[model samples]
Target: MAGKLSVLAVVALATAAVFPSSVSAQPPLPPGPVTMIVGWPAGGPSDAVARLVGAHMAKALNQPVMIDNRAGAGGNIGSDAAARARADGSTIMLATVASHGLNSALYTRLNHDPLKDFAPIGLITTSPSVLLVPRDSPLHSVRELIEKARAQPGKLNYGSGGVGSSQHLAGASFKKLAGVDIAHIPYKGTAPAMTDLMAGRVDLVLTTGAMSFIRSNKVRALAVAAPRRLPALPDVPTFDEAGLKGFHTDSWYGLVAPAGTPRPVLEQLNAALATALRDPELERQFSEQGSLPVKPMGVDEFWNFVRKQMPTAAEQVRISGAKAE
Candidate 1:
C-alpha cells in the first residue's frame, strides 16, 4: 500500500509540473479573439457603440474584439444568439434597450429571458431620441407636425428601425401624447429608415443616431425627446419646448455575457470595459454623437440597474401599445 501511494503521488506531481494548478485557479483570457454580438445592423446606434467601445476594450485586454451583427426580429436574433453562446467569456454581446428592457414586454414568444439569460458586464451609454424631418419637408416644428397630423389623420407617417425599437416607442409615444393618427412605417434597420426619410419616402423619424445627418443638414431636428436640448444640437428644442410636454425616450447600450459565464471572467471583462470608458477620446466621440457614456459600476450594481430598467421599459411598451410578434 505504501508503494502504491508513492506511485500515485509521483503521478500527481508530474501532472502538476506539466500543467500548473495555478492555471485552473487563474482563468486565461478568453480562449482567442472575442466576438461581440450586436443586435442591430452595422450603422445603428447599438452597432456604433459596440464598435467604438469594443475597439477600446480590445486595446485594454490586448485581444481582438469582433462585432457580429445579427439584426432581426427587433434585436432578438443577436440577443438570442448571445444568450445561447458558450458561457466562456469568448462570446459576449452589446445588449440594448430593445433587447434587455423592452423586448420582454414587446415579444410574446421570446426564447430567452431578458434578465435571466445575461450576466451584466456594464452599461455603455445612453442617448435621447430626436424627432427629425427631411430638410425640405413642409413641417417646420413639432407643433406643425402635430397640427398636420391632426388635420390629416393617418396622412403623416413616422419611420422606425423596427416595430419595438426605441424609435418606434418614441414615435408611438408621440402619437399617443399628441393625440394624432399618424401611420407607422417600420424598416429593417435605422439606416434604411433614415435613407427613406432623406428620400422623402417617410415623413419623419424619431431616432437616436442621426447626428451626422443633422450635422450635415440632411435632416432637420424638430425636437429632442428629452428634458433639455443636447449640447450637440443646442439650437434644437426639447419636446416640451416644442409644445409636447412629458415626452422622453432615451436609449441605452450595455455589455452582457451568457448567464453561466464565470464570475472571474465577468470581473475581468468589467475591468477592461471600465478602462476603455476612461479614454478621453472615446468620451469626446460619444459626446459629439449626442450619446453620453455611463459612469462605471460594479457587476452587481449594473445588474440592479438593468432590473430597475425593466419596469420602465414595460410601461413604455404599454403606453406605445406595441404588440408581440
Candidate 2:
C-alpha cells in the first residue's frame, strides 16, 4: 500500500512538472509588467486576441500585461524587435502567420530568423480569409469573377491592405491559380482598401475577420479560402468548391518569447497561456470575431508545427512572387 502511494506521488509530481505553476511550491515569475508586443495596430484580430489572453494571463500570474503595437513590414518590424529583446520573461511577442511563416518566405532578407530567434509558446487563434465583393455587384460567384478577370485581363484590379500582407498573398495566389491578370492595387491599410472594395473602387478583396459584414448584407462572400466551409458562413463555399482546389490561406496568431528565455519561464508562460485560452468567455469572444481558439500545445510541439509549415509558406511566396517592399 505504501509503495502504491509513493508511485502515485511520483506520477503526480511528474504531471505537475509539465507546467511551472506552483505545483510543488515552485517559485513565481519575477516581478514587473510583461510586455506583449503585437505586430499590428490595435483593434485587429491579433491585437484583440493578445489583449484577451493578456487579460487572463495577468490575473493568473499576478502581474500586469502591457500591449505594445509595432505595426509594419507585414509584422516583421515588431517581430524583429521581439527577436532582439533580452532573453528574459519580461518581453514577448504575439506572432502571426505573416510574421513567422510567410514573411520568412516572402522577403529575400530579414534581420531576424523566425524559427531561431523565438521560443515557441503556443498558438492563440486562427482566422481564415474570405472572398468578398461589393453587395450590389453583378458577380455572383467565384467562377464569374474569374471569368471576368480573365476576360478583362489587367483591367480588373484587386486590393490588399499592403504589400506582403496575407491579403496580398491570397490575392496573388488566387490570380496565379485562376490564371487571371488582375492588376494588384496596394492600399496603406485594410480599412481604406475595404472601403474602396465596398465602394466599387476595387473589384474584389480577399478579406479576413468574421462574416458579420456578410451576415449584415454589406458584402457578398463568394468563397472561403479555407480547407472547409466556416460554420458561421455555411452557405459560402470553399475555394475548392469554386474549382480552385487547395487554395487555403489563414491568418493565425501565436505567443513567442526571445529564443533564449529560460525553460522554466517558458513553461510558466505556456501554462498561463493554456489556461487563459481555455476560458469559456474568451473562447466565445474569439468565435464571435470569426477566430477559433486553438488548444495549447507543448513548446517543442509548437516549434515543430512552425517548422513543418515553412516549406509550404516558401512555396506560396515563390508562386505568388510576393516580396517585402
Candidate 3:
C-alpha cells in the first residue's frame, strides 16, 4: 500500500508539472487604435460601409477605429498598402469586391496577391448593381436596352468606374449573356460615370444603388443585377426576371488583416463584427443603401469565397477584354 501511494503521488506531481494551469491561459489582446484602410475616396460605397462597421468595431474593441482612404489605381494603392502593413492587429483593411477578388483577374501585373497577402476577417455585406439610363432617354427597360444594342451593334456606349470594376464587369456580363454589342467607356470613378449617364453623355451605367441619380429619378433603373427585386425598388425587375436568366453580380465588402496576424485577434474582430451585424439600426442603415448584412464567417469561409469568386471574375475579365492599362 505504501509503494502504491508513493507511485500515485509521483504521477500527480509529474502530471501537474507537464500541464501547468498557465499553459491554457490566453494572453489578453494588445491595446492600440485600430485603423481600417479603405481603398476608395470618402462617400463611396466601400467608404460608407467601412465607416459604419468601423464605428461598431471601435465600440466593441474599446478603441478608436480610423478609416484611412487611400484611393487610386482601381483600389490597388490602398490594398497594396494594407497588404504590406505589419501583421500587428492594429492595421486592417475594408477590402471591396474589386481589391479582394476582381483586381487579380483584371490587372495584368498586380504587385500583390489578394489571397497571399492578407488574412480575411469576415464578409460584411453585399449590394447589387442597378442598371440606370437617363430618365428622358428612349430606353424603358432591360429588353429595350438589349433591343437597342442589338439593333445598333457597337453603337450603344455604357460607362463604368474603371476597366475592371464591378460596374464594368456587370456591364460586360450583361452584354455577353444578352448577346448585344456595346461600347464601354471607362471613367475615373462611379460618380463621374453616373454624372455622364445623367447628362445623357453615356447611354447607360451599371452602378451601386447608392448613386443619387437612381434615387432622385435623374436616371431610371432599368434592371438590378440581383437574384431578387430589392425592397427599396420593388417595381424594378431583377436581371433574371427581366429576361437575363442566371444573371447576378454584387458589390461585396469584407474585413481583412495583413497575413500572419494572430488568430486570437482575428477571432476578436470577427466577434465584434458579428455583434455589429446584429444591430437593428445598422441593419436599417445598410438596407437603406441597398446593402444586405451578411452573417460573419470565419477565415476559412472568407478565403473559400475569394477562391470561388476569383476564377469567375478572371474569366469575365478575359471575356470582356478588360485590361489594366
Candidate 4:
C-alpha cells in the first residue's frame, strides 16, 4: 500500500508539471490581440459600447483589443462564432439580451447554446423602452389604447424595429397582458417605424430614447417598461403604475468569454469590465445614449443576473410568436 501511494503521488506531480492547473497557467497577457465580437452593425449602440469597453480593457490587459463586427441573422452570426471560439482567454463576446436570451427561444435551430457556450462576465447596461403614441392619436393612455385595441382588434397596429427585437417583445407583452389584439408591423429599422408613427401610419411604438421626441411634441409617452420613471421623462408612468402588473422588458448588454476559459483569466477580465463600466466618462456616454448601467457585480452575481433574464426572454419570444428556422 505504501509503494502504490508513492507511485500515485509521482503521477500527480508529473501531470501538474506537464499541465499547469488553471490557476497557475493563467497568462498575464493573451498570446495575441483579443477579439471582442459584436453581434450588431457598426455605429449602433451595441457597437459604441463595445468600442468604449474595449478601449478600457485594452489598457487593463496591456494588449490590443480588436472589435469584430459580424452583424447578421439578428445577432446570431457573431454569437455563434463566439460560442465556437477556443476556451483560451483571447476571444470574448459582447452579448445582449437578443443573443444570450431571446434568440434561444426565437430561433428554431441555433448553432450555439446561449447560456452554456459562454461564461457570463458581467452585465454592462440595460435600455428600457417607453410605450408611445402619436401626439395627436385618439388614445390618451395605456388603458385607452387597450380599450381601443379590444374594440377594434387587428385594426390597431404597432411597429417594431424588426421581428423578434426587444421592441417587438415589449409590444407583444403589452398585448398579452392587456388581453388585446394589435397587429404587428415589422419594419427594416426603428427610424422608419418612428417616422411612420409620427406620420400616423402606425398606431403605436415603444421607444428607448423618448426624451427628444417627447420634448419635440411629436410623440406621447403613455407608459414605460422600466423600474421607475425615467429622469428625462418624469411624466411617463411605469407599466406597473399604469396598471399593467408585472410587465417589464429591456435591451440588456453583457460581456462573456467562451466556456472553459481559465478562472484566473476570466476574473481579471471581469474586474477590468466592472472598472470600465464605473468610469465617469462611460457613465456619461451611456446616459447620452439613453442606457443605464446595470448594477455592478462580481462574476457569480453577474451569472445570476443573466440567468434570471432567460425565462422572461423566453416568454417574450413566445408572445411575439417569432421564429427563425
Best by TM-score: 1
lDDT of 4 by residue, 253-299 (tens): 88999988877777888888878887888877677666786667888
Estimate candidate 2's alpha-carbon lDDT, on a 0 to 1 scale: 0.82
Give me the runs in candidate 2 sitting further than 4 Å from their true place: 1-28
Worst-scoring 10-residue span by lDDT in model 2: 19-28
Superpose all Cα atoms of candidate 2 onto the true structure and report the RMSD in Å to 1 decimal.
Answer: 6.9
lDDT of 2 at 140: 93
Mind giving the per-residue lDDT tens digits that candidate 3 earns over 134-220? Answer: 889998988888998999999999998776678888888788888989888987667677778879999998877464566777889
Clashes of each: 0, 0, 0, 0
Candidate No. with top lDDT: 1
How would you order the candidates by lDDT, starting with the best?
Answer: 1, 3, 2, 4
Model 1: worst 10 consecutive residues (lDDT sum)? 22-31
Better of 3 and 4 by TM-score: 3
Which scores greater on lDDT, model 1 or model 4? 1
* Cα displacement (Å) at residue 19, model 2: 24
Expressed as tens digits, the lDDT of each residue in 1-325 for candidate 2 is 9999999999989987775455344333568999999877665556677898899889878899999988777777888899999777889999777787888778889899998889988877888889889999899999899888878889888887677777889889888888889888876556667778878888888867735667788789999888888877788899999988888887777899998887788888889888888889888877766676687888888888878877877788899876666
Q: Rate the local accuracy (lDDT) of all candidates.
A: 0.88, 0.82, 0.82, 0.79
